[model samples]
Each structure stands twice: as structure tokens, then as C-alpha cells.
Target: MFDVAPTELLLVAVVALLVIGPKDLPRAMHFVGKWVGKARGVARQFRSGMDTMIREAELAEMEKQWAAENERIMREHPPAPSLSAPEAESADGADMHDLPPLMVAQPDIRPEPVAAEAPVSEVEEPKTRGQGEHPL
Candidate 1:
């Protein structure tokens, strides 16, 4: 983000060398490097925390949308009335025994047995080039 050109960087380095002096420049640079590393670490942590918060917010928003949609759908299509034993009897004036069984008889649908296949014959190996034969 800091638009530092090569010339600008060279100028800064020359000024630092002159101000800090060559004898203590190495130590000063090391100290600056350590602080830069720490700053970068903090920035990375902050970015990750922001990302996590954003993702959580998105998830919560999606959940709310889903709930609203579910409510809308439920309102649009009401549930059908369930037929309890008493309700069924009162409505039709018929006993439970008079009703047909829930499950109907299914026809046997097993597959037919397949006939055994003929055994395959063994193949003969071709002669190699070394056995008085020319290679193709």
C-alpha cells in the first residue's frame, strides 16, 4: 500500500545509514525487522478475526432467510387433517374391521434362475522369437 519506489527506498536506506552510522546500523535494522514482523502478525490476526465475524454474520442471515421462507411455505399450504380412529369411525359410521387392510397381497416377482454357461477352452501360447521364429 505504501507506494515506495526503488529510488525512494535507496534514499531512505542511505539516510538511515548516515544517521544511525554504519557501526550500529546492523543492530538498528534487526530491531526494526523484529517490530515489522510483530506488526504483520497483529494485522494478520485482525484480518482473520474480521473474516470470521463476517462469515458468522452471513450464516445467521441465511438461517433467518430460511426460517422466513419456511414460515411462508407453511402459511401457503396448510397441513391436511390426520385421520384418527375416532374421527374415521364418526365420519363414515363404519367399524375399523370394515376397512380394507393397509397392505395388499403382492405377486411373487423373483427372477428366474439362469442356466450354467459352457466352460471356456484353454488357449495355446505362441512361440517366442528365440524359439526358431521371426519377431513380427
Candidate 2:
């Protein structure tokens, strides 16, 4: 599982035989294999524990940030000043029926000056040459 190919394993076995002698090499190899397995298991357990702790920390941080953001939003835009419908609806909203009388503007009914007229034409029709003569 260490990703060591067959050639690498053979090389390690040869080295172990040379270093520890053929008589003791088998015992050394057995102990070494067990130790590697234990090391891998410990590593996996540690990595999983770290992953769990990190996720928990991230969740807690997000919750805190959300709480802070909500508090800020509330401070920025407190509930609008409440008024009765008759007091709040102005004539500016044409669709509103319960508008307050005080919101209406006074109408200006003064007469405006009339617009000037352009000169009129007396002729009823204009004349044109016939195209049957020739192409110019």
C-alpha cells in the first residue's frame, strides 16, 4: 500500500539481507511491516479528527458571522415609523383610495395663452408633368 512497486520491494529486501543478515532478516521484516501498518492507521485517525474539528470550527464561525450581520442590518434599518393607513397613504399614489386630505395639492386652474397658427394654403392641388413624354 505504500505504492512501492515490485522492483523497489526486491531492492529493499536485498538491502535488508545485506544489512541484517539472512538469519535475522525475516524477523526484522515482520516487525517493520507491522510498524508501517500501525503508523498508517494512526495517520488516518489523526487526519479524520482534524477534518472533523475544522468543519465544526467553520460552522461556528459562520453562525457567529451571521449573528453579527443580522445585528448590523437591524441597526441600519430599524422598523419603519408606523402610521395609520389614512395618515400614510398620500395622493402621490394614484391607486390609493384612503389617502389623507392633507397630502393633496392645490390645483391651478388659470387660463393659458393660445398657440399661434401657421399660414394657410389657398390652392387645393399641385400640378405635375406627365412621365409618358421621355425618361430624363
Candidate 3:
């Protein structure tokens, strides 16, 4: 991503060594290298996790879209039983049971609660106390 060449990196390293004197130059370079490596590792791990989560989310969305599309297609072109087109009706011995497993849904049908014409309460007889029962 930096697009930095090898020559440019060497030049920068020389400048750093010159700026940081001979006594502390090696130590400073070591520390900088370690920090850079750590930063790169952390960024790589974070990007990997982000990519995995993004792919999983995309897959879930795709499945939802596919399911919606399938439902739309199923609604648009319903399975209709053909009676006069082919083998079900052309022969002299026609099979009346040859029917496709499809029919129009009853739009007027509704799930209504069934009402009973009787009361729900029932009579109960008083019970006698047991041998170990205590009276309140």
C-alpha cells in the first residue's frame, strides 16, 4: 500500500542512522522494527476477522434474497392440474385420478373460533376428611 521502493527504504534507514548517533542507532532501529512488525500483525489479524464476518453476513443476505425470489416464482407460476392436454384425457380409458398436486387456495376461508352451546362449569361433591387430616 505504501508503494515504497527498496532504494527509498535504504535511504530512509541511512538518514535515521545518521540522525540517531552511533551509540544508540542500532537499538533505535531494533525498537522501530519490532513496533512495525507488531503493528502489521495486529492490522493483518483485524482485517482477516473483518473479512470473515463480512463474508458470513453477505452469505446470509444472499440466502434471504434467494428464498424471497423462490417464493415469488412459486407464487407467480403455480402448479395447475392439466386435464385435456395429454395422456390424462386422450385415451379411451381415461384415468380420472390422474391429477396434479395443486389447487387454488380458498381465499374466503378463515380460521374462525368454534362456539359451543353449553356452559363450562361442573358440580363437585364435598369430600370427607382423611384419617391424618388436620382441621383448620
Candidate 4:
């Protein structure tokens, strides 16, 4: 990056105007432009703190791979044994024959009656040439 060329930057500005002399060469080029703007603001804050620690280590490795894929999909789908009414009685507990009969069908959800919309007549206004109408 130090390939200075325009005739070696005009021979380093004629040897820094003959060893910084034009009355202190504009305060030595304003102290080398304030230390090259504080070394480019500390290299842009160390490249945004190494891009925020690489996006927090890639969001903590995608939350530990989404918590190990939600614990392997809850250990391969395991959750359906609820039964309740006293576990559907049976062992000489006044028998409900280990429960398995619940039907339930009611779904007609009635709502289909909407066809009556024809009443909007009023648009006749274009008759202004009756003096032997012939403007073809």
C-alpha cells in the first residue's frame, strides 16, 4: 500500500518543503492529519469488535442447534396417554369396558342465504342537440 508514485509524491513534497520549513509546514501538516485520524478510528473500532464477536458466535451456534433439535423432537414424538374418568374404570370398578365409544357429530354451522341485490336505476343525461340533429 505504500506505492507512492506521482514522482514519488513529488519527491515527498520536495523533502517535506525542505525539512518542514515553510514556517513549520502548516504545523507539520496538522500533526500528520491528527495521527491519520487516530489510525482510522482504531481501525473502525477493531472492525466493529470483530463484527460483534462474529454475531455472538453465530447466535451461540444457533442456540446449540435449536437445543439439539428440541431434544430430538421430544425423543421422537412421545406424549399421548391421558385417559381420566378414573382411567375409564374396568377392573371390577363398575365396568365402563375400558372406554372406547364417543361419537359426537354435530356440525351444520348454518349460514347460506344472501342473494337479493338488484335496485340501482338512475343514469340518463345526454340530450343537447335537437335542432335537427345531424352532427355525424
Candidate 5:
């Protein structure tokens, strides 16, 4: 990280040995190593956090752009004709009911056919319950 060549590093080490003394040099080196490791760990954590923040910001920007594009596209190409029937027509003596069945728009849903009901005499009816009374 310091961009110091091997010769420069050796020179620094020699200077450190003279200043710090040969006796405590190893201990000092060990302490420096620990501090460097901690610094690297903190720097790594900071970098990861910044990356996460950047990703979130990018995602938000993309979403905004997407929404704007969607709006533009919708405006450019309006929706197809509405499926609902119009409220009224101005033609004289022309009733809406007079239109042929095929000409009128039919609902997409088809109703279920009702089952044939059994004869009242053939089916036993449940007895009616009185006020607060259970039907047995």
C-alpha cells in the first residue's frame, strides 16, 4: 500500500531498528502487524457497506427510470377500445335493444346451468325452527 520498494523497506527497517532498539523491535513489529490487520478489516467492512449503498441507489434509479418509460410508452400507445358499452346513442328512433345479439358485446363469463329441481312431493323438507328452538 505504501508503494515502497524492497530497498526502501529495508532502509526503513534499519532506521526502525536503530530508533526502537533491537530488544523491543520484535514486539513493536508484532504490535504494528496487529494494527495493520485491524485497519484492513475495518477498511474491508467500510468498502462492503459502501458497495451495498451504491447497489440500493442504483436499483432505486432503475425503478424510477422504468416507471417513467412505462408512462411514456402508455401515453404513446393508448389502451385498446373500452369493453364497456356506451351510455347513449343520438340516432333518432334507434333503440339499443334493437341491435342484433351478435352485434352486442357479450360478457366473457358463461353462467352455470341450473340443475333440474326435484319435485316437492319427492323431497323431504327440513322442519322450520321456532324462536331459540333447535330443529330436530
Candidate 6:
């Protein structure tokens, strides 16, 4: 994270060894590593929380769009009327059988015959370029 090259890190280590001494250098390095690891863990947790919130927001928007489309479809094609109990059954408790029959008509289609082409006649010999024009 500090962008330290190998040579620069070596220089820093030598200085740290002279200042902090060899005995306490390992303990100080260990403590710093622990703090860096904790900072990374917190950053990872925050990133995951933001990702979860973004996903939930996207899902909520999709659900709203779906609901709007469903409502539009329902408005476009309303439900068919239901027959009442009295209308479905006759007075003597018999079922009614008076539904009208449906009629569908289809047009007849036929292919027409193709006409035969006439034979081509042979062409006569062509005249020279100067035959039909006057000299300039």
C-alpha cells in the first residue's frame, strides 16, 4: 500500500533496526501487520454491505416494474363474466345447455397457372457505324 520498492524497503528496515533495535523490531512489525489486517477486514465488510444494499435496491425496482406491467396487462384484457347460479341451472335443478355454436369461415386459395413465353427470332447482320450518319 505504501508503494515501497525492495531497495527502499531494505533502507527503511536498516534505519528501523538502528532506531528501534533488533530486539523490539519483530514485535513492532507484528503489531503493525495486525492493524493493517484489521483495516482490510473492515473495508471488505463495508464493501459487501454496499453491494448487498445495491442489489436490494435493484430488486425492488424490478419488482415495481413487474407489478406495473402486470397491472397494464390486466387492464388491457379484463376477466370474462361469470354465470350466476340461477343462470347456470334451470328451475328444475337441471343444468342449462343453450350455449350458441361458434361459426368460423376460411377463404379458398388457389394458385394461378403461369403463361408460356414466345420463342425469340434470330437477328439480322448489323450495319457499319457510318451507314446511318452523314459525314461531319
* Model 1 Cα lDDT, one tens digit per residue, 1-136: 9999999999999999999999999999999999999999999999999999999999999999999999999999988899775535636678767888789789989999999998988988876679877776
- Highest lDDT model number: 1
- Point out the higher-scoring one by lDDT: 1 or 4: 1
Model 5 ranges with Cα > 4 A deviation: 81-136
In angstroms, give how far residue 28 of model 1 lies from its true place.
Answer: 0.9
Q: Write the per-residue lDDT of candidate 2 for residues 64-108, one digit (tens) a residue.
A: 999999999999999888876663344576645564444677798
List the candidates' TM-scores in order. Answer: 0.62, 0.44, 0.48, 0.36, 0.56, 0.54
lDDT of 2 at 105: 78
Give candidate 6 misplaced runs (Cα > 4 Å).
1-4, 83-136
Alpha-carbon RMSD, candidate 6: 9.3
Go through the candidates in order and give each one's C-alpha lDDT. Answer: 0.92, 0.85, 0.87, 0.89, 0.90, 0.89
Worst 10 residues of 5 by lDDT: 87-96
Segments of candidate 3 deviating more than 4 angstroms: 76-136
Off by over 4 Å in 1: 87-136
RMSD of 5: 14.9
lDDT of 2: 0.85
Residues 1-136 of candidate 6 have per-residue lDDT tens digits of 5787999989988999999999999999999899999999999999999999999999999999999999999999998888665557658776566646557787888889888988888987976678877766
lDDT tens digits by residue: candidate 4, 1-136: 5777799888988899998878999999999999999999999999999999999999999999999999999899977888666645656776576567778998989899999999998999877787789878
Please name the candidate that would achieve the greatest TM-score relative to the true structure: 1
Off by over 4 Å in 4: 1-14, 17-22, 33-35, 71-73, 77-136
Q: Per-residue lDDT for 1-136 in model 5, tens only?
A: 6687999999999999999999999999999999999999999999999999999999999999999999999999999997988755448857667766556776799899999998667667776678678665
